[model samples]
Target chain A: MEISYRDMITVLHGMGFGVLFMLAFSGAIGVIYATTVVGPQWPRSQWDNAMFRFYLISMAALAWLATISGAYIIYPWYRAVPPAGTTDLSAYPRALLLSSPRTAGWHDIGMEWKEHIAWFTPIAMTMVAYVFIKYGPRLALHRQMRNAVLGFTAVAFFSTAVAGLFGAFLNKYAPVRGGPDIVLMQEK
Target chain B: MSAEHQPIGLPTGPGAAAILAAGIGSLALGVFSFAGDAVPAINRAFIFWQPSGALSGVTITAIVIWLVSWFGLSRRWAGRDVALGTVNVAAFVMLVVALLLTFPPFMDLLQEI
Candidate 1:
């Protein structure tokens, strides 16, 4: 079996990094809630607190990886303009989506929104991680700080959800396909 | 913090700075994106890298803004507990506004005016 390089990278960008980051939100949110809401009732040791901080840091790292890969590596290919008078627009995903009125909205709305909104996830997540790391279990003491951290994490979750959903739909309609073919298992 | 490093109960100032800077960075992204969409000249100008188009510049600029604001605010309020109520509300408001601004429909709606 053979797969195009672009398809593999695109999958890595979306399913690999993006989806992993999205999945992490549930765990991160649960731990954040526990840190702020229930941790005050039961004190955690430095080890436990450090573990929670590490989790947040890992989530933030995933978010950064997802965003950077999408924007720098995948996005350039996705938005590559078709040469003049190009009849077959298969190589250009953006033009392909825009060539037909039926699919034009995918580029105009879905992609436009996805590219921009996706960024908030990393920024918000970084802040959440930093705040949690800074305060750790003591977050419960400062209620305002605790709430803001929770709120930002929630925003990161919401941002990634929107971006990931749109990304799935966009790929379904106009997949980013190109680059050298990579061979998997072959007859030997 | 790493396992070797201890996480103390830092003052709210540091946390607030991070939160506010995130909000500002998000808002900057929304603004730059909308501006690039609405103005052809601005769009062309934002093409810092040819391959990535305006997106390269937009994101980089926003990140620079985020880091700078974070550094400035952190230095300004480190150790001291700043007024968090105002910072919290302002940050949330900025986040909400950034969300609205990034929405395509909202951008179109505002552009129509």
Candidate 2:
């Protein structure tokens, strides 16, 4: 899976753009709220009470499991997928990250990214849970929030399952081939 | 502060919104950025299915957990104990989402070729 320098450049550009997008969207929104809305809203909810305290304790347990399990299972699988020399193609479908012979050294770096990125999942999940505990339910509109969470979770789960089956099939049989020297091989 | 003082829980309005917004934003950026690049043949085959691997089972699990927690914490949320119900729900939801993303979909697309 030798990628051309041009392809490498494109992939790097895409990564840069992704980081920028995150900064613009989440980082910017966070800053604005912390400075204005979050401060003014202040702490309407407090965990000082017993029930809140119990719930947080339980949530902590669940979160710890999620983090440990996710790291143990997902991280290794994620690292194994790309092998070492393949291009840093978009995880989304269709975009083949092109890499060249000259830029082969970069493959080591890209592999490192894949190995480490999934580890962030546990940290992110933990943080998300912590925030929810601190603020309590932010959705004053109970009906709306419940419905939205149900719908979103439903879609996410279904889509991910379908994707998994598809990948399994592809890995089993229909691997695509690239340049002549590099024959596609399936890994366990 | 016991281990209970700092356990992972659920997200409220701001937390939920942040995750939702970020998910939508990432999906949007993924699409926008990849639109111009050459779609890898392997990616083409599995792209549509990736979301399936990323979102399904965890979503179902999260919903179930939330409902159960809602019932269990009903006593507490009634002002008897601090607010626990919502935090429980949020924690469950976060766990589901995080677990699902670990599915092979996010990492295996490139390997197909």
Candidate 3:
């Protein structure tokens, strides 16, 4: 019935953008592989190439959205400093996780890795998009280039998976919470 | 395969530049992240935005390096066909090493040395 603005944004960051980008990888890779690896089986029409570019562009956009929002918007709330003699640390996710030895690993490992590793997603995907767009059908000719592209795509996916997995667990352990509560529906 | 499918006349340097640049960017993130964790001074220096802590600087710097390197490499390579084999190996090595460097366990292990 009620979700805070911070929580909603976190969900949008992790699910709306992050997970959507993750899901888009499959389609992107499949098409890239199909177009490159199995070139003869399919027609490399201009429309096909255009749609592929659009799909990759959208995926890259989602990757940027997820990374930017996570780093700029929600992270500030998550890492907010607790005033002197503050007993309750629910408002500060980083502090809340660190306050407990049992939960400290979640912050130290989960967040530390996610914060930096998640970045590779956008950078790699953007490059992947650019390479694909620039090379297009000609990509099939350069076997080495094709392999490298696939490798980067797979790594991009790996980075997203690692970040997503850790993100879900981190939220479970110490969620980024604050901001005005948004009412979803009135409880009858 | 038609003339267009032929690899000889085609330009791969631009694509190669983008690929290598991504590897460089990824490695930069790893190196910066590790340095920020290992050194207090480095950590403080990386706080470009107070809200995001060192992560803001780490990512921003890496992106800048990626773009700059890409631009420089692309301009230099242009239509010239560089050695794709060597570039591929170097890029993959850097990328994989960078990925491992970001992992906390790997960072911890390296820091212990």
The number of the candidate with the highest TM-score is 3
Measured against the true two-chain complex, the DockQ scores of the candidates, in the order shown, are 0.50, 0.04, 0.67
Across A32-100, the per-residue lDDT of candidate 3 in tens digits comes to 788675763333688888888888899999999999999999888888999989999988888999999
The number of the candidate with the highest DockQ is 3
User: TM-score of B chain for each model?
Assistant: 0.89, 0.27, 0.91
Chain A TM-scores, per candidate, are 0.94, 0.28, 0.95
Q: What's candidate 2's i-RMS value?
A: 12.5
As a whole number from 0 to 100, the lDDT of residue B79 in candidate 1 is 83
Candidate 2 local lDDT, residue A108: 30
Could you arrange the candidates by DockQ from highest to lowest? 3, 1, 2
lDDT at residue B73 of model 1 (Cα atoms): 97
lDDT winner: 3
Error of 1 at A96 (Å): 0.8
DockQ, candidate 1, vs. native dimer? 0.50
In order, what lDDT does every prediction score?
0.86, 0.34, 0.87
Task: Please provide, for model 2 over B22-50, each residue's C-alpha lDDT reduced to its tens digit, 9 standing for 90 to 100.
Answer: 34332322332222122455234433324
Model 2 segments more than 4 A misplaced: A1-141, A174-188, B1-13, B36-113
lDDT of model 3 at position A65:
96
Residues A10-56 of candidate 1 have per-residue lDDT tens digits of: 88988998888878888877877886668654236777777777888
